[model samples]
Target: MATYIISSFRNHNKHVTYTSLISTSVNHTQILEEFHKFQYMQTKVFVVHGSPSISSRLFSMAKDVGMMSEGYTWIVTSKTTNFLKFMDSKAIESMQGAVGFKSYFPKSSKFHGLKHFMGLKEVDYDGMWAYDAVYALAMAVERLQTKKHVTKLALLDHILRTTFRGLGGEFKFVNERTLLRPIEVKNVIGKGDKRVGFSIVNGEFVKKMGKTNSSTNNGLEHIVFPGGHTSILNHRRLQVNGKKMRILVPVFGGFKNILQMVVDPKTNLSNVSGFCGDVFNVAFNVLNHKVDIEFVPYLFEEGRTFNDLIDKVYYKEFDAAVGDITITSNRSRYVDFTLPYSDMGVGTLVRNADKSIWIFLSPLNADLWFTSAGFFLFLGFVIWVIEHRTNEEFQGSTTQQIGTTLWFAFSTLVYAHREKLESNLSRFVVTVWVFVVLVLTSSYTATLSSLLTVQQIALKGGSVQFQGISPVKAAVYNNVKLNEDVLVELRSADDYAKALRNGRVGAIIDEILYIKSVLALYSRHEFSLVATSSTTNGFGFVFQKGSTLAKDISTQIAKLREDGTLKALEDKWLERQSSIMSNDFPAVSPNILNLYGLRGLFLISGVSMAFALLVSMVYLAREKCQGRSKMEMLRRVSKICPTPSTCTR
Candidate 1:
């Protein structure tokens, strides 16, 4: 029985060093022919493997083993064949040779083989024997277990002189880069459980199903070659078989482009003159060439300002701008533009607090009604008191009842209270009063509820901070005019205002409403708005003309637009009162996104309304009970007093 182990590694790019170094090793055909020419009696070689880095480590072990010594015939076996077939063959034939098998790993590439059914799909690993050989050598040394002060050279002698069983087979020392291991061949069991004869050790067939121990009674059955270190098996048991080209896309950004910022390393675009839609459409088409896109962002950095980044005709200084770029007549002379994706719109941004429900429920709004109710009740009390003072006939009548009844009407509206009466006429009055009180209570509650609802809706909608901002002005100020106008890019709104005041830039062109509001808020820095013939310069990609890639991309973009996909993206971003850059500004120091800002305002308002209602109900109920009890007690005491006719003045 003759067996040889082989493995090899080479650069994927097929570098020259790889070819030169790997060429020295034996090929699969040469290895097979050598095996056929076997002149030796029962022999087996367990090959070791390591990549570029691991190969160096194996070389160190070989030096200590003296495999490279002058007297030794150093025959480094590099046969790239699967030795399993030699172990398995009845006459010595086992497995197929394959190359580039690392592709079978789970992450890199995927493959399905016959062994996959046994749960061994991604079992491919590198440098297996370089490490495994160390284990086999360690086991052999453990078997000796001698404490006779063994030196490195003596230990090397001990290993090379003994034999033992190891993971590969019968562990025995050969020359450098080679290990003689006894092979164990088992019968081939068919998928149906039919078994055939197989080799027991080193390619020799043996039938033994009982317990077998590799260790002998005297010592271990495997020995290590102390002077020899294993080599990194580069050539594996495989052939190239085929070749194909594949396109690869590395991940550039995170979180699906949700936070594509102007200052970010990737997607840094120049000012382009286009509405938000056109700029983003061009950018998306360029980045993603897929025909069918599930989602797309509406506003991107390319259209962030009105600047043209791409050059169609050609210039010397720069090529194109990715973010918003100024599109001017000069720019048109040099560059081309794609069809407009969406028109720009100027809109308002309102604060959430201004439209909150609490704002409408404020005391100021209800003050007039409360005051009217109080004044009427006061007038009725004063009239009843004056009538009692001036008319003798009216003195006998219950002026107290009139005052109390009138006051109760006031309390009922502002607070919840009812009056108690004794006379039959008073009883009739009280019944009517209760009915009127219920109706008034329901009306006030309903009105308050509706007002609160409207306030809530308004708050949710938010107050427009800036109204009707002109994109044309923004284009001019952002230097989107390019060579047509001498304008500087304003990093921030404040900077633009400063430039306007300092007369550094001709005019601060921006969305008009935002500038107006900003100016109003600042009180300094005033500039005149420069009006221009606004051309709806849509943002577009600047690709080499007649390129097939460009054509394919344009088709995909058109499909996205036709199916309302682009519109959906627009609705997602443009409908918002503020842009992403606007919300991210440092003024407010919002710890989280603006979405949290809106939602938090609603949550606080709802909680406050609920709390206020609870307090108001408690206060109203207590006041009502106290006023009625005090009035009834006074009436009872008056009835028990001395007769009015005989009482002293």
Candidate 2:
């Protein structure tokens, strides 16, 4: 009955938490071991089941552990109470003070005499029910004789609706459903179940009905609890009169919003805020309890790591340690931990490559540049040889000839080599050279323009100096590879950024999840992150190794996670979690028509246009001077003048 009530309580929106479920199929030792697995939940409320023998051993075990007291509540079920039919010394000795209820108790005078005559110590409700069922069947058979036909289904239907006032209260079957009956509540005292109270059909336990505060005994005998106590024990809140709970909080810094330590100016009281505190607060509220939490800064004490802080709980220094305390195997050995509330891991924060004036050259490798240069030289050489003798513009002294050859070869780049081809071979070679230059220049100009237009270029290889210590440093080594490997030891994230800006450290290795907050905290858009290392553990509340509050707190945490409270806390503090692990660079598209790329074209056009204007003016002036025919002057201006074979040598 206790198990049913407790289990039903859990189903009522999980009003309670059952930490462990032990089956009777297991051996005696396994059962005890299973019980041992649940530690000090501060307040112990045990629901014992199984036969009298099992209950005897379990109560013996509970008694050995000091669980038999007023602070504890041990309620057994009908099976346990029924096991007490004989009330042997062993059963009574182990179950001296327990509470249980029996389903029914037959109270007929004839049945009572028969029980007494048969050496039966208690009411025979089971016998009475069986006897009633037999008489009812006999009555049905007698009625069957009156009917034309007798059917078992009809008899069963008649039996199902049968009603009577028998040993069991208002014995009735309505549509195959038994009418609701109240279970008698009893206290195990002096080898028998003593009626201390009764459970009503409406689900209320009346310990003493119609009693006031003025009544000394509340109209009931003094009830005894196992281990001989009269007050309820609560494991969560210690035995203080609602005083402030001393919660040992970690003083370490740099977990951006999850935990922050502060001192009240007016009261000088240290307060803890952030996701951890919020989660604890919410969990406590869900459990319908509260503790006046006083954040005690103890992790700040000299010569202490987080393990030492966990030790405080193991030694019962304070109620619990609240912070981003990770749950690990080593830690579990010393102190109990609640279920993990936050997922965390290792990540890296690094300075991106610096952008410089010549950053425009980043798109192409040296091979491409060298190859383009060699190809241009080859084209110039090929054009010079093809145009030298036939074209007049290529005829000059040795130095002039070399200059004109180079000029003729290079000037075809923008279709500005004005000397017309005299030979078809020279025109063919020039046409092909111009086409090659067009493609090369067009591609080069497009690429360079893209490189320049981007306001910021993501830096890479040989520039960043990684700095962090230990497993994180090791993680960085595994996750990131540098061109110039120089890992330095650094302090805080601010130091990391300062180092990057001042050209010191290139990157900082830390938990990626934490570094994300750092990036958002500082708004370091220039920085880049490359993280892949998985974090081994998560944050949880801590408790004494045997503390049962660990189970209760864990249950509440699981509940919080299920109902989105945990997620909401994460969202509240870590709202700006960075996505730098993506490592995506801005997509660079070629800008072919930018003014910088077309500067040479503009210069050449202006110079050529100026020359044409000068020549047209000169031709018009000469025409006016000689009073020559306009058509002759126009032809003179358009004609290509022949070069002297060797420049006046």
Q: Write the per-residue lDDT of candidate 1 for residues 51-129, one digit (tens) a residue.
A: 4222233333334433222212121122211222223232111111111111111221222332354466333233333
After superposition, candidate 1 runs with Cα above 4 Å error: 1-360, 363-371, 378-406, 411-558, 561-649
Cα lDDT of model 2 by residue, 1-649, tens digit: 4566667755653334344555546577876665554333343566766676667777777666655654567778877775566657766776766778766553557666667788977654566668678766776676677789878899887766676665554566643754455566778887577887655555565554333333334434567876576444456334333356567887656553667777789998787777787888788667665456678876444556677787777766677888867667777877778888776555455555556787656555665566545545555555455556456777778898778666665677777776766655445555555655676577777677766654322343324433222234544565555433566655455666777677665455565445655666665457655443454455788976555667888999988889888877866876655243342342333433344544464345334434444554565588677766776776665564334444344
TM-score of 2: 0.46
Off by over 4 Å in 2: 1-66, 69-248, 254-258, 264-269, 274-288, 292-294, 298-321, 325-355, 365-368, 382-471, 481-485, 512-649
Please, what is the TM-score per model?
0.24, 0.46
Q: What is the C-alpha lDDT of each candidate?
A: 0.35, 0.62
Please, what's the RMSD in Å of model 2? 15.3
Candidate 2: 10-residue stretch with minimal lDDT? 462-471
Query: Which candidate ranks first by lDDT, i.e. highest?
Result: 2
Largest TM-score belongs to which candidate? 2
